[model samples]
Target: MEPRDTATRYDQIARWWQSQHQNSSYGIAQLKRAIQFTAQRYLALDVGCGSSGRFINVLLQHGFEAEGLDISREMIQLAKEQHPGTTFYTEDICCWIPPKSYSLISAWDSTFHLPLNQQEPVTKKLCNALEPGGVLIFTCGGGSINGEISGSFQGQDFDYSTLGVDAFLQILTEQHCTCRHLEYDQYPENHVYIIAQKCDRSTSTTPN
Candidate 1:
């Protein structure tokens, strides 16, 4: 499901995704955990924020000023409409440069969509984008190796890839983040999530 037109595919479903999100609690639950783990309620970034602005809203409610980025222009448009005063970017996370360091960064269900090859590097960039003691929370398609999986959503094909559990932990550790929580609690579905905290540079370990 590595469609040549990823952005367009999501654009086609932007409204549908937004409408359906109202009844979903998945994002909210993850955000609650992210907030609990975050040391500061300063600035937060929601990578791959879809039209719903669910994560962004949660950040705001908990005292963080939030901004978002999504690969789909239509999704960004819808998010802007839903959250008039918030900033939302339409750029692929794999190539985008984070504008500022954040105390909280939540990729949630988004980063798994990046190709397997981009996982480590992009993740490292994300870790570097965090301020000391900042928290990073994201989900991955649980597995032991690198690979891709395809699925159809609302009749459109989409792809998900991962660098596996071990690789993910290694990358985070190399970026000087401590793995605080890694849960496959949503087992049987290949869904795994992790909450990691950036260590203060003074006490950080240099990756060999």
Candidate 2:
């Protein structure tokens, strides 16, 4: 099935997703890494934010004024109710353009669901959306090369795809982002995450 199809499926299960993820720790590691790498907390964007405001809440705790974007209208609606003060948009990250740059961006386990063909372009766009010295945290399949796969979520099948490490590095490099950290967050699982920072004109690399 096409990756875009997940939007409809997610819309149908928005509440179920919110219930499951409300108290989850699956993305805590990535969020912590982002918080560490982000020096400024002016603004943050959460892509594919699902129906839970958990990450948005964390960003607020870190002093960031946060916003979110998701493809599912149902998900956005649920998130808006949970986070009335935080802005949330219903748009596909594959084609959505940021109105302004962000100090920090988190895709968590979201971007991997984009079509394989759209992965690289979207990655590059997201990297470009970063303000100078901005931090971007995202996840991808921990495979050695570019590929796609199918997975079942709550009995419904969905597609997951990635441009892999090589393409990711290339996009980061082209966008002048320093790869700060990368790891298979769930070691036994294929869940890989990365923390990268857009280079400030004065600094060639992120601080160690």
Q: Could you estimate the TM-score for every candidate?
A: 0.93, 0.95
Tens-digit per-residue lDDT, 1-208, candidate 2: 4546878999889999899988888788679877898767899999999998889989888899999999989999999999998888889887798898999999988899988899988999899999998999999998879998998888778899978787898889999999999988788988889899998876664678
Report each candidate's C-alpha RMSD, comma-separated, in the order given: 2.6, 2.5
Predicted candidate 1 versus true structure: per-residue lDDT over 140-203, tens digit per residue: 9889988898889898888899998998999998988999989996778789999999997665
Clashing pairs in 2: none
Please give the distance, in angstroms, between residue 89's alpha carbon in candidate 2 and its true position after superposition. 1.0
User: Which candidate comes out best when scored by TM-score?
Assistant: 2
Q: Kindly report which residue stretches of model 1 are placed more than 4 angstroms away from their true locations once superposed.
A: 1-4, 201-208
lDDT for 100 (candidate 1): 94
How many clashes does the backbone of model 1 have? 0
